[model samples]
Each structure stands twice: as structure tokens, then as C-alpha cells.
Target chain A: MKVLVTVKEVAEADDDFAIEGTDIAESDLEYDLNEWDDYAVEAAVQLAEAGIADEVVTVTVGRERTEETIRMALAKGADRAVRVWDEALDGAFADVASKVDLFEAVVAEEEPDLVLGGVQAADTGFGATGVALAERIGFEHAAVVNDLDVDADAGVAHVHRELEGGVEELTEVDLPAVLTVQTGLNEPRYASLRGIRQAQRKEIAAKDLSDLGLTADDVESSLTITSMYEPESESDAEMIEGDAGESADRLAEVLREKGVSA
Target chain B: MSVLVAAEHRRGALRDVSYEAITAGRELADARGADLHVAVIGGDVDGFAEDLNRDGVDAIHTVADGEEFDHNAYQAALSQLADGIDAGAVVLPNSVNGLDYAPALAEALGVPIVTDAVGMAYDDGLTVTREMYGSKVETTVDVAGDRFVLTVRGGEWPPAEGVGDAAIESVDVDVPESGARVTGFEEVGGGDVDIADADVLVSVGRGIEEEENIELIEDLADALGATLSASRPIVDNGWLPKNRQVGQSGKVVTPDVYIAVGISGAVQHVAGMKGSDTIVAINTDPNAPIFDIADYGIVGDLFDVVPELIDEFA
Candidate 1:
């Protein structure tokens, strides 16, 4: 089976960053392989290592700058990568449908038997794209999957969906499915020096909308950001001020006042 | 046009988010000058319908189906329900199951979807307020059309109370067989410690950095005479056990005093511990959401402050 993992390079804002128009200042935002997608990549790569998957290809909808993050997935063990970006997706909030469109196009071309992605992105945090893509492409899907066991012979993926609370629902999804992975699914391995060197030579196929036979209008987002600002601090926390020792003394005093101590 | 809310139930009990969704649904219904219709699908729908007949509810529609949540059933049933009611806006809980179907339902309806909405306003069109950068920055999203699906964050709206005279009706719907089959449910976090029983908790998070450094937190927990607990990442990393995890998917701790060390206070972690009597945060990032709910805070590195804190108690 061929597995395709959807990877994203999410931007996280630094503490005390300035808001520029509708987003955090570029200088203040740091990009990294989304924490969740890292696990998804590991899951896909593990499928290959287990001989359940013949190839593990990663697909992403990001700019050229994201190749570094995409290559990080390759170094960790994705065979190749496909990155799609266009000017239409530059500043707009790509709604769920818009993203599904991109992924659907890639899926049609790749024809992978299995698709995987993170449950949610750290930045947008929409938590919708994978399922939405499943709906669009007509495939079975399980979201928030913390445990995945693929039985290639039976063409079933036994997954544990981590519902709210401490309960997990065991579900068996047929092959040709999408599973949005949750964190803690697996420990993502760090890229070894040998793997990193090999990744430097791996192919990262960067494409525009036209390359996928898509037009700019096909990816227009219906949702727009009207305003962006820091949420006003609603905290009334009495912050302990001073050096570590002084703060520790104050915290201990507070703990003692709360009737807590050794 | 009406606002439709799909009530969620699991294991014969309605989740709190169902009532919360009713409140959110009424808000949008009122703003849109439409009736609020609540739909409860599957597993004792008749009983669920009665419980969902809260204030501002105009009607309750029940679709008898399977015992547990099946996204295929929800997407098919709710899509037909929303269509029948001509719901201009659909309000649902932003819970895990809700996310499973909301996006698909929105796609099926060919409308936009806004997930994890903390705030909403319907003047002419709709505007949603949601968090970004893990709740550091708040942004207002404008939906171009009046027809959209919104998944409201749990705890954002108070659950609707006071039973209203709502007309109950059973709606027959065609739910397609799915390629996914749920086999069973297993309860996790069964271990030695129940963090919920603790009076005082000294919780550690990712800021503890390495697995070996967790001993530092255990030392502090010992000196303070408090139980040692952790955030999700710590448990996820195997640095701590699931029994010691305090989060939405872990034990909900309402300790007398909760000390959050190196935890950035993600919403899931906050959901489990926000009810604690008192919260104290220690982290280098002053803007962490943990500090927002904390009664006391120390804006410094855990590495620097923890040893000193252990010394103070020693």
C-alpha cells in the first residue's frame, strides 16, 4: 500500500510578539514542522519499515520556505515530497474546502491507498481539513486517532480514536482511508546525520496551482480575518517579582498560607 | 430559517457540551430571527429529546440510530435534519466527535465552516472570534454568507437551563452504511494515582525538558507534601504516567492548590484543571495561557526557579 502523509509547516508566535495587520509579525513567528504532523510522518514511515507500505510520500500546501520543514520529514523517512502553493493562498485563510481541493487534487494524482495527517494544525487549529478531504474524495476517515494498526491482508486499519476524557473508541476502517493522527500516537524519531545527508539529495517537487490543474479562483477562501489582536489579559495573578530565590521564598510563603507544606 | 444544534451523548449520558451547544444555538437563532431546533440522534433519542428541551428551544427532533457516535450517521442525519429545518446556521459543540462530522456536514451542505469558535456575532452576516497561536492572539473571522456551520468551544457558553415547552418529533432519515465500524471502547489512565483525589498538586509539563529532570519536580512534590502530576505532553512523552496527567483526556483535578511548572497551559490541559481552588504558574513565557487562570505566577525559567523552590521548602 502507498501512504501519503499531509505535512504542514506551522508558524508559532513568540511571546510578546507584535501583530502586523491580521497576523503576527513575520520576524516574530517561528516556523517548524507541526508538532502533530511530525507524529503522522513517523507513523507513515513506520508503515514502510514494517513492510505494510511500499512508499511513504508527503504532501504539503505551503510556500517554498516550508521546504526546510518538509525535508525534515524526508530526513525522518518520507520517500519524497509534494508542496503546492499559489499567490491566492498567500494572505487568505484557506477555508476547509479550499484545502480539501488541493489535497484532493494531489490524491487523484498520487492515487495513494492510504492518507494520513495531523488532527489539527498548531497555527490555524481548524481540525477539519482531513475529514473534509475524506468527505470530498469519498473515503473512510477516523479523526483524532491515537493508535493505528493496519492489517494489510484484511485491508483494514484498526484505530483507537481518542475521544474526550480517558476513553478510546476502537474502530476498524477499511483501506483507502484517511486517519487524522493525534499526538502521543508515536514518538517521532529525530533525523539522524546520515538521514539528513540523504534528505539533501531527495526530491521536493514544488508546484503552483496550475500544475495541479487548478486555478487561483478554485482556492479562494470564503472566510476573511476582519481583525487580529492580542487577547486582553484577564488574569488577576499576583506575580512573584524578583530573582529565583526571592520568588521561591514568596511562592513557599503562599503555599504555606494555603495550608500546604511538608 | 432556523438554527440547528446536534446534541451529543455517549454511553447513555448526554455530554455537557450538548447543553452548551443549545445555548450557542439559541444565541444565533435569536440574532437571525429564527427558531432554535435541537436534534438528538441515536441511542434513546426519546429520552435525549426531553433533556434537550431547554429554554429557547422551539423543537426537538430525534433520529433513532446506533447506540454510539458514528460520524457517517451524524453527517447523514444532521445534513438531512438541517436541510429539513432550512437551518441557516448550525451550531455544534467543538468536541472530538463534533469535529468528526461538522466539517463533512459543512462540505455536504456546501457552506463554510468555522471551528472552535469562542465568540460569535450575527449582524447582517456572521463573525466568529477564535484563538490563534495557541490562544495568545485572538482574531475575528468574517463569513461571507449567513449560511455556515460553527463548532463552539466547550465552556465558552453556559449550558442552557430551564425546560421549555418544545414540540418533540421523530424524524425518519436515511443513514448510509459506513466503511468504518466501531468495535469497543477502552478506558485509559487506570493506574496507582488518581490525581483528582489529591488536595495539592505539583504538576510538571514539557518545560521539565528531559526525562531525567522530572526527578526535580518529584523532589519539589515531596518537599511541598503534594502529589506529583503533569500536563498532557509530559504524559505523552512517557516522562509521567497517564494517571498523573491533568487534561481533557486525562483526570480532571480540582486540587486545593495546583502548581503548574513549565506548562504552557494549552486549552485541553486547562479544561481539566481550571476548576482547581487555586492555581500557581511557573514558566519563562509570561504570556502562557496557564498564567491567565493562575492565581499566582512566577515568570522565570523552571530550571532556575524549581531548584530554588525545592530549597525554600527544604
Candidate 2:
């Protein structure tokens, strides 16, 4: 079985984020592979190591700098890396529909037995891209999956989806499907020195949107941001200042005032 | 124009978030001067529909099929229902099932979507308020297109109340062949001591550091006569069972008094227990976001404070 894992390069905001024009400033951002996608990469790598999957190809949509993220995946054991970028997608990062369009094109090119992605990006947190990509590509999909077992011969995958209220739903999805993985699915392995050296030799292919036969017009956003600002602190919490003992005593007193403690 | 709310249910019982969606849908409908309609899809959902007939609801549409939630059935049924009713805006809970189908439904309908909306306003078009960067920043998004889809965050809106005699309408639609079949639900954490039932929650976070320290939190819970709960890390680390976890991916709990120990309070963790009446945060970091929402904060180490707290209560 071959697996295609979609990774994302997201900006980790500094202590403060400022909106430059319509979006956050690039300077105040430190970019890394999305926290959730690390789990997706780990899941794919585990499958390959267990011989359940013959190959794992990782892909991402970003500018030139995003190749670093794809390389990070390769270092974690992905067989190959592909970076999908287009000038047309410059500001299209905020649009799930457009991102889905680009990802669908990538999936068509890869033609893997399974496609996996982080349930949502750390930055945008859209959580819609994977399912939308699945819909656009006409594949069976599941979201927020914590556990996955693939039966390649049977062409079905048994997955455990994390639901609210600490309940998990066990579902069986037909193969050639897309799955958005949840966090804590697996502990992502650190890139070994040997693995890093091997990744440098691995081929990292780059694809433009035009190569996928998609135009900027074809991928347009239905939602637009009107304004961005810091959320005001709703509560003026009373901070009890003192050592551990004094603070605890004051907190207990406050609790008593609130009728929470006798 | 009609605002359609997709009611979420499990085994024929409506979830609390379903009512929250209805409340949000009512607000959107009123803003647009449109009628509010709810769609309940499941087997034996007539009772669920009847339960959804709250004030501001104009109609209840039921599709009696699929005992469990199937993505294909929900996507097909909701899109068909929205199309049939010419829905101007569709409101859904930002839940596991709702998030699963919302995007595909929006795509099929060719409508704009704003998900995880904590607040919303409609003036000619919809403007949704959402959190970004772990809820540190809030963004107000303006949606384009005449029709839109929104998934309201749970606990943001109060449940719809009062009574309304909504006309029940049964809709017949073809559910497409599902690519996935739900086998069954397995309750995590042994289905023991539901945190939702606890009036006071003694929650531990990553600051607890190690599994052995969990006994310290357990002792604190026993001192306060509160139930023991934890953040995702503790559960993910296998130090505590998954049921003790509280957060978006875990359980939304509204205990009367919540004491967060060694918790920095990420938005995901806060989302679960923010509804607690009195939140007492014990973290050494004074800048921890948990302190922002805490009713009373102790900027001290939980290792020291918790034992003292336990002794004080004793």
C-alpha cells in the first residue's frame, strides 16, 4: 500500500501578533511544520516501518520556504516529498475551498492508496480542508481519527474517530480514502542524523498550480476577513500575590467568600 | 429566506449543542428577517424533532433513516434539505459530526462557510467572530455570497428556550452509498465518573509533570470533595484515563467550582471548563492565559500550593 500524507507549514506567532493590512505580519511569525501534521507524518512512517505501506509520499502547499517542512517529513521516514505552490495561492491560504482545489490536483497526481492530513492547521484552524479535499476528489473520508488500521487486501480501513464526551466511534472506510488525523494519534519520531543525511539526497519535487491545470480564477474565496484584533480580557481576575502558602490561604479565603468552601 | 439549523442527535436523543445551534440559528434568522427551520436526521427522530420545537423555530424537518451518523447520509440529506427550503444560512454545531459534514455540504451547495464561529452578526451579509492563535486574537470575518454555512462553537450561545408549536415536516431523500460505516461507539475511560456530573473539578495539566504527581491532585480532589479531571496531555500521556480529560476533543464540563492546577489553560483546555462558575487557577506563570479567566488566581507552584490547599481543606 502507498500512502500520501499532506503536511502544512504554519507560522508560530510570537508573544504578540499584529495585523499588517489584512493579515498578520510575517516578521512576527516563526514557521514550522504544523503541530498536528507531525502526527500525520508519524502515522505514515509507522505504517511504512510496519510493512503495511510500501511507500509514504508527503506533500504541502506553500511558498519556496515550505520545502523545509516537506524535508522534515522525509527525515521522519516519508519516501518522497512534493511541494505544491503557485503565485495564485499567495493569499489563498485563508480560503479552504481554494486550498482544497490545489490539494485535489496534488492527490490526483500522486494517486496513492491512502491520503492523510492533520485534522486542522495550527494557524488557520479551518479543519475543513481535508474533508473538502476528499469531497472534491470523490473519496471516502473521516475526520478527527485517532486510530487507523488498514486492510490493504480487503480494501478497507478500520478507524477510531474521537468524538465529544470521551466517546469514540469505530468506523470502517473503504480504501482509496482520505483521513484527517487527530493529535495524540502517535508520538512523532525525532529526525535522526542518518535520516537527515538521507533526506538531503531524497528528491523534493515542486509543482505549480498551473501544472495541475488550475487557474487563480478557478480557486476563489467565498469568505473574506473584514477585521482582526486582539480579544479583550473578559474577566478581571483577582491575582493573589504571595508565596505558595500565603497564596493558597488567600485562595481558600476567596473560595469561602464565594460560598464554594465552608 | 430561511435559516436552517441541523440538529445533532445520538441514538434518537438530541445533544445539548443541538439546542445551542438552534439558539444561534434563531439569532441569525431574526437578523435576516427569515424563518428558522431545523433538520433532524436519524432513525426514529420524531421525538428529537418534537424536542427541538423551541421558540423562534418556524418548522422541524425530519429524515428518518440511518441509525448512526453516516457522513454520506448527512451530507446528502442536509444539502437536499437546504436546497429544498432555499436556506439563506445554515447553522450547525462545531462538533465531530457537524464538522465532518459541514464542509462537504457547503461545497455541494456552493455556499461560503465560516466555521467555529463564537459570535455572529448579520447586516446585509453575515459577519462571524472567530478565535485565532489559540484564542489569543479574535477575528471578524465577512462572508461573501448570498447563502452561507456556519458552525457555532459549543458553549458560546445559550440553548433555545420557551415553547413553540413548530409544524413537523417529513422529508424523503436518497442517502448516497456511504464509503464509511460506523460499527459502534466505545466509551473511553471505562465510562466511569462522568466529569459532567461533578460540581467541583480538581483538574491537573502538564504542569503536574509526572504520573506519580497525579496522586497529589487526587489527594487535592479528595480534600475538596471534588472529582478529578485533567487536561489532554495527562490523558494522552496515559497518566490518567481519557474520561478525566476536559477540552474540545474531550468533554465540555461546567462544574460549579473548577480548580485548575499546573494548567496554563490552552484554548482547547479552557473550552471544556470555561463555563465553571468559579475558576481558581494555580500556576507559577503569572502570564498564563488561565489566570485571565480565573476568578481567583494563585501565582505559585501547584506542588506547594496543592498540598497546602489539601491541608487547608482538611
Candidate 3:
């Protein structure tokens, strides 16, 4: 079985994420593969490790800087990498870049047996791209999927979706499907130094929309970021000075004053 | 302007969130002076359609056949339904399934999707309010177009009331051949509690220190007959299962009473439980964000306060 995994370049999860006025300052932050995307890569790699997949292809949408992410994916064990490089892409749709349209364009061309991506991009956190892509492709889609098993011979995959009330529903579908891997889907493997060197020798395909017979007119951005600003701080902590028993009493008094407990 | 709300169900039993989404859609329709229409899709959803009509829905479009809850299939059918009815806006409940189709549905109609939406108002255009950045802040999103998709946050709105003579209409939306198929679903077992339905919840956070100390919180939960829950940190640390995580990343709950111990509330954590009737916060830091929305706050260590609270409740 062959699988296609989608990756995104996002602010590293460890970034300070300072919301200054309305703008999120990405200037001081380091860039890396999105945390959730790592799970998608790992899930695909696991399929190979389990001898369930014959090939795993990692796909990313970005310009030259994003190649580093693709290389990292290779280090994590993807057989190959495909980067759709558009220098004019500005990460916004209307004038520059749009996440949904760009992803839809990529999926339409790849047409893989299975597609996987992180549930949401950490930076924008729109959490809609994978679902949107699935819709555009008219593939069966499930989000927040923590577990997946595919029947290679039968060309069908069963996905375990996390739902409210601790209830899970199993949806079995054919291949050429889209599933968004959530955090905790799998423990992502680290890219060893040896793996990084091997990635340099691996093939990474570069493509454009025109080559894929797709057009920019196929995408549009509905929401606009009017301004980015930092949120005003709204909390103040008061230390209760005492040992366990005394502090408990004082806490009780506060709760009572606030009408929390009689 | 006509409001379009999507109905979600498994087999034939409708999800409670559908009622909430319709309530939210009803609000938008009320503000826009339009009728509210619900689109019910599944293999067999007649019962769901009947339930939806009880909410005073102006019309119901029941699209049956195929595996009922597939997102890709739902999006295509919804897009067709939205176009056929000329809906001003489409609304969805922000569940895993809802998030899957909202953006795609919006894109298919060439509109923007306002996700995690909590409230809506219509003026010259439709205005939506949503929380961003883990609920550390609230922002209002206004879309200028007539057709858009909106996914309402869970537990944000009350379910729609059954008050009108709204009749159910059977609308056949040709089921497109699904590119993906559901083969199976398995449930993860923790069995400690069902957080969404709990009347009272005792949630722990990073401040609790070690996993062993969780027993203390559980003791308190038992005393009050409340469910035990935790922030994403606890679940990430393996102190609890993923289902117990309460934040934008996990389940959202609106219990009647919520007691948070050792939890320095992050915006994401608060976004999940801010709807609780009464919030009592027990944290060492007096200035923890949990105290901001907390009705009763105890500025004390959970190790000290939890035992006493448990004993007192006993």
C-alpha cells in the first residue's frame, strides 16, 4: 500500500508566542515541522515498520525554506518528499497564500491511496485544512483520529475517531482517503544525524500549479486579519501564606465569600 | 436570509450537539429576519429529521443512504443542499466531524468559515464571536458575504426549543460515491467518568505534581459525586487518558459545578469549562487565570486544601 502524508511549517511548539497588540510575533520564534504533522509522519512510518505499506511519500506546501521540513520528514523515514514551491506564496489566500486552497491543490495532484495531516496548524490554528481538503477531493474524512489500521489487500482502512463522552466510532472506508492524525497518535521518532545525511541523497520532487493543471483562481480567502495585537493580561495570583491546615481554612473562607461553598 | 444548520447523528440517534447548533443557527436567523432550515444527512435519519422539526425548524432536508457520518460525503451533500435552498449562512456544531467539513463546505461555496464560533449577530453583514489562542482572548469575526459556514463551540448555546408547527420535508440529496469508506471504530477505555454529562467536575492540572497525588483529587470527586477530569498537561504526562483532557484540545464541558484544584488555568483550559455554573478554584497562585472566571477562589496549595475539602464534604 502507498500513503501520502502532508506536513506544514509552523512556529516551533516551544516558542514564547507573544501576542503583541494584534500581531503574533513570529520574528523571534524558531520554525519547525508542526507538532501534529509529526504524528502523521510517524503514523505512516509505522505502517512501513509494520510491513503494511510498500511506500510512504511526504508532501509539503511552501517555498524553499520548507525544504528543511521535508528533509526532516525524510529523516523520520518517509521514502520521498514532494515540495510545491511557489515563491509568491505569502501564507494568505486573497493576495498571497491560502492554507485550504493550497492543500486542496496538492491533494488533487498527488491522488495517493491515503492522505494524512496534522489536525490543525499551530500558528493559525484554523484546524480546517485537512477536512477542507478531503471535501474538495470528495474523499471520506475523519479528524482527531488517534488510531488507524488499513487492509492493504482489500484496499480499505478502518479509523478510530475520538468523540465526546468517551465514545468512539469506527469508520471503515476504502483507500485514497484522508485522515487527520491528532496528537498522541504515535510517538514521533527523532531524526538521527545519519538519517539527515541520507535525506540529502533522497529524491525531493518540486512542482508548480501550472504543471498540475491547477489555477490560483481555484482558491479564495474569506476571513481577513484586520490587525494582530497582544491580549491584555487578566489574572493576578495571591499567595496564601500558611501551612496545610491553616491555608485550607483561609481558602474555605475565600470560597465562602465568593458563594462557591456554604 | 435563510439559516442552514447541519444535523449529525449515528445510526438514527441524533447528537445532542445538533440541537445546540440549531439553537445557534436560530439566533442568526432571528437576527437576520429569516427562517431556520436544518439539513439532516445519514444512511437513515428520518427520526433525526423528526426531532429536528421539534425545534421549530422552518424546514428539514433528510439526505439518507451511504455510511451516515462521513465528512467528505456530508460536505458535498451540504454544499448541494446549501446551493439549492439559497441559504444565507450554514452552521455546524464544532465537533470532530463538524471541523472536518466546515472549511471545505465554506470553500465549496466560496465563503469564509468562522470556526469555534460562540455567538452571532446580523447587521449589514453577519457578525460572529469566537475565542482564539486557546481562549486567552475573544475576537469577533464579521463576514461580508451572504453565504458562509460557521461552527459553534460546544456548550456555548442552549438547545433550540420545540415551539412551532415546523414540518419535516424529505429531500433526496444524491449520495456521491465516497472516496473514503469507514471500516471500523474502536473505543478507548478509561471508564473513570463521562466529563460532558457530569453535574460537577473536579479537574486537576500541572500544579498537582505527581500522579500518586491524583488519588486526593479523586477522593474529593467522590465526596461530591463529581467527575474527575484534568487539563491537557495531565493527559500528556500520562496521569490520565486523552479523553480526560479539558481544553480546546480535548472535551468541552458545562457542568453545574466545577472545582478546579492545583490548576493554573490556561486560556485553552478555561475555554473548555468556563460555562460551568459555579467555578471554585484552588491554586497556590492567587493570580492564576483560573481565578479570573472563578466565582470562588482559594489561594492555597491543593495538597493542603483538597484533603480538607474532601473531609468537609464527607
Candidate 4:
């Protein structure tokens, strides 16, 4: 079985994020593999190690910087890595449909038996790309999956979905499906020194829009960014000024005033 | 053109988020000078539709077909309704269930989608504001399409009031066979004490360091007569039951007083407790994002502050 996992590289903004033109300033911004996607990569690698899957392939869509993020996945035991990016894909970040379109193009090429992705990207937080990609590729899908049991022989996947209100629902889904994994599903293993060295020899393939047989117009963004601004503050926090004992006493007095304490 | 709002319901009762969606849908409809239509999909949802017949809604579309909240049934029903009414925009609560279908429904209707919308407006076109970088940065996006699907964040908009009686319209659509089926719901972390019902919450986060440290938090909770709650990490580590977990994936809570101990305030955790009347954050890091939304902040170690607070309350 071949499992394809999707990962993304997101920028961790400084406390004061500077707006550089239409986007956040790049300087002083640290980029890493999206925190959520780490679980997807971990799940894929575990399935491969357990012999439930033959190969684990990782894919991402971004510029050259994204190669480092994909390499992290490779070091973690993925068989191969693919990066899909083009100048046309720059504006696609504003909209998820175009991202879904690009992912559909990539998934068509890989032809994996199972697809896994983070429930949502740390940057966009849309939480819709995986499901949309499933629709685009004509595959059944599930989202926010915390527990998964796959029966490849029966071509079915049993999943435990984390719903609101601390409720969990167990569902059975047909195979050749997409699953958007939630966090805490498993503890992701770190790459060892030997694994890092071996990853250097592994293949990292790059594909652009033309290679996917798509042009800029075909993947035009369905959304635009008209403006950007900080959200208005409701109220500034009143910092208690004192040592721990004094501060606790002051907090108790405040709580009493608020009728929370007697 | 009309704006369609998907009403969320569990069992037979309408979820609070359904009304929140209506509130957002009403704003979009008024801005576009169009009608607002709401779709309620489930079994025996006539009562649910009536509850949705608020002042801003022009029509309430009800489909009594699915037994439970099935994602595929919702997608099929919503896509058909949106197409039938020629909806210019579709609005839903940015929830687990809503996110489940928003993408597939958008694909089915051949439209674009924007999820987790905190703010939205229409000026020649639709623009949505979304929080990124754990709410440290906000991005305003202009949806470049004639029609779009949006999942509005819960609790951002006030629930719509029922004033004008909306006409109930029964819509029939083919419910496709879903590849998945919900067997049943299993309550985790024990269901005895629901944090949502608590008036005061003493919530712990990763800063507690170890499972044994939870006793300190519990002692504080006992002294203050507050319910014991935790963030995702504590629950994931099995230090707390899933029922005591407070967050987007666990439970949304709005207690009268929320004392966040060692919580750095990630967006997901903040989404659940931001509605509290008074928020107190205790963390070692002064720059913790939890301080931004906290009504009161103590940039001291929780281990030090918590015991002091417990002693004071005692």
C-alpha cells in the first residue's frame, strides 16, 4: 500500500509582524513544517513501519523554502518527497480552491491508495483543503480523525472522529479515501543522526503548474485580499502588581467584587 | 440573489451555532440586498426550522431525511438547496461538522470556500477576515467569485433574535449513500461533570509539567469552588479526562470567572474560553498570548502563584 501525506511550511510570526506589501514581512520570520501536518507525516510513517503500508510519500506546495520542510518528513522515514509550486501559485494562498486544484493535480500523479493531511494548516486554518481535495479527486473522506484502524484487505478504514462537547463518533469508511488527521493522534518520532544523513540521499522532486498541465488562469485564485488590520481589543488586561501572595490576595478581592467569590 | 445559512442541529434540538450562522447570514444578506434562506437537515426538524424563523430570515428550508448528523447527507442536501435557490453565498458555523461539509459542498456547487471567518463584508465582492499565527495576525481576504461558501467562527456573532415569522419551505433532495456512517457517540473523560455548566473554572495547561502537578491545580479548584479544567495537552497526556478538557475540539466554556493556570493561550484553547466574563492568566512568560485576552494577568510562575492563590482562598 502507498500512503501519501500532505505537509505545509508556515511562517512563525514575530510578536510584531510587519506587513511587507500584501503579506507578512519575511525578515525575522521563522519558517518550519506546519505543526499540525507533523501528525499526518507521523501516521504515514507508523503505518509503513507496521507493515500495513509499503511506501510513505510526502507532498507539499510552496516555493523553494518548502523543500526544507519536506526534507524533515523524509528524515522521519518517508520514502519520497514532492514539492508543487510555481509563480502562479503565489496568489493562490488567498483562496483555498486554487490550493485544492493544485493538490488535485499532484494527487492525480502520485496515485496513492490512501491520503492523509493535517486537519488544517497553521497558516490558513481553513480546515477544508483535505476534504475539498478528496472531492476533487473523487474519493471518500473523513476529517478531524483522532483514531484510525485500517483493514486494507477489506478496503475499508475505521476511524474515530473527535466531535464537539467531548463526544467521539466511530465511523467506517471505504478505502482509497482521504483522512484529515487531528493532533494528539500519535507521538511523532524525531529523526536520528543516521536518518538525517540518509535523507540527504533521498529524492526530492519538484513540479510546477506546467508540469501538472495547468496554466495560471486554470489555477486563478477565487479570493483576494482587500485589506489587513489588527482586531480591536475589547479591554486591556489589568496587570496585578505585587509578589505572588499579594497578587493572589488582590485577585481574590477582585473575584469577590465580581460576585464569583464570597 | 439569496444567502443560504446551514442550520446545525444535534439530535432534535438546534445548536446555538445555528443561530450564530443565521446572524452572520443576515448581515451578508442585508449587505448584498438579498434574501436570507436557512436550511435545516436532519430527522424531524420542523421544530428546529421554527426556532430558526427569526426576524432576518426570509425562508427556512427543512429536509427531514437523515437520522443523524451525517456529513455526506448534509453536503448533498446543502449543495442541492444552494443550487436550487441560486444562492449567492452560503454561510455555516466554522465547526467540526460545518468544516466537514463546507469543502465538499463547495466542490459540488462549483464555488469557492473561505473557512473560519471572523469578519465578513460585501463591497462589490465578499471579503472575509481570518485569524492566523494563533490569532497573532489577522488577514482580510477578498473572495473573487460571484458565489462563495463561508464558515463563520462561532461566538463571534450574537445569536439572531426571533421577531418576524419566516415562511417554512420543505425541500426534497436525493440523499446520496455516504461512504461513512456514524455508529454512535461515546462520551470521553466521564460525563458526570460537564465543564460547560461550571460558573468558575480553574484550567491547567502544559506548564503544569507533569501528571502529579495536577493535584496542585485540583487543590486550587477545591479552595475556590471552581471546576477543574485543562487544555488539550493535559488531556492528551491522560492527566485529565477528555470531559474536563476545554477547547475547540473538547468543549466551549463560558464560565463567570476563568482562571487559566500555566496556559499560554493558543488560538484553539482561547476559542473555547474567550467568552468568559473574567479571565485570569498565570504563566511564566510575560509575552504569552493568553495575556492578550486575559482580563487580569500575572507574569509569574503558576507553581508559585497557584499555591498562593489557593492559600488566599482558603
| Alpha-carbon lDDT, every model | 0.93, 0.85, 0.74, 0.85
Q: What is the Å distance of residue B178 in model 1 from its true position?
A: 1.1
B240, model 4: CA deviation in Å?
3.6
TM-score, cand. 4: 0.91
lDDT per residue (tens digit) for residues B32-137 in model 3: 8888889888756776776787555898887776645777668777888888878878999888778867777886786777777766677878767665544444
Colliding pairs, model 2 = none
lDDT of 2 by residue, A107-170 (tens): 8788888999998888777788888778888888999999988888899989999987778999
| DockQ of every candidate | 0.87, 0.58, 0.29, 0.57
Residue B9 shift from truth in candidate 3, angstroms: 3.4
Considering chain A alone, report the TM-score of candidate 3 relative to the true chain A: 0.81
True contacts reproduced, candidate 4: 0.69
Classified by CAPRI criteria, candidate 2 counts as medium
For model 2 chain A, give the 10-residue run with minimal summed lDDT: A253-262
Which of candidates 1 and 2 reaches a greater lDDT? 1
Identify the runs in model 4 with alpha carbons over 4 angstroms from their true place: A91-94, A242-249, A252-262, B191-200, B207-227, B237-239, B252-257, B274-278, B284-289, B301-314
Candidate 1 Cα outliers beyond 4 Å, as residue runs? none
Task: For candidate 1, write residues B1-314 as lDDT tens digits.
Answer: 99999999999999999999999999888888999999999999999998999889999999999899999999988999888889989998899999889999999999999999999888989999999988889999999888999999999999999989999999888988899999999999988888889999999998888999999999999999999999989887988888898989898889999999999999999999999999999999988889899999999998999999889878
Residue A180 displacement in candidate 1 (angstroms) = 0.3
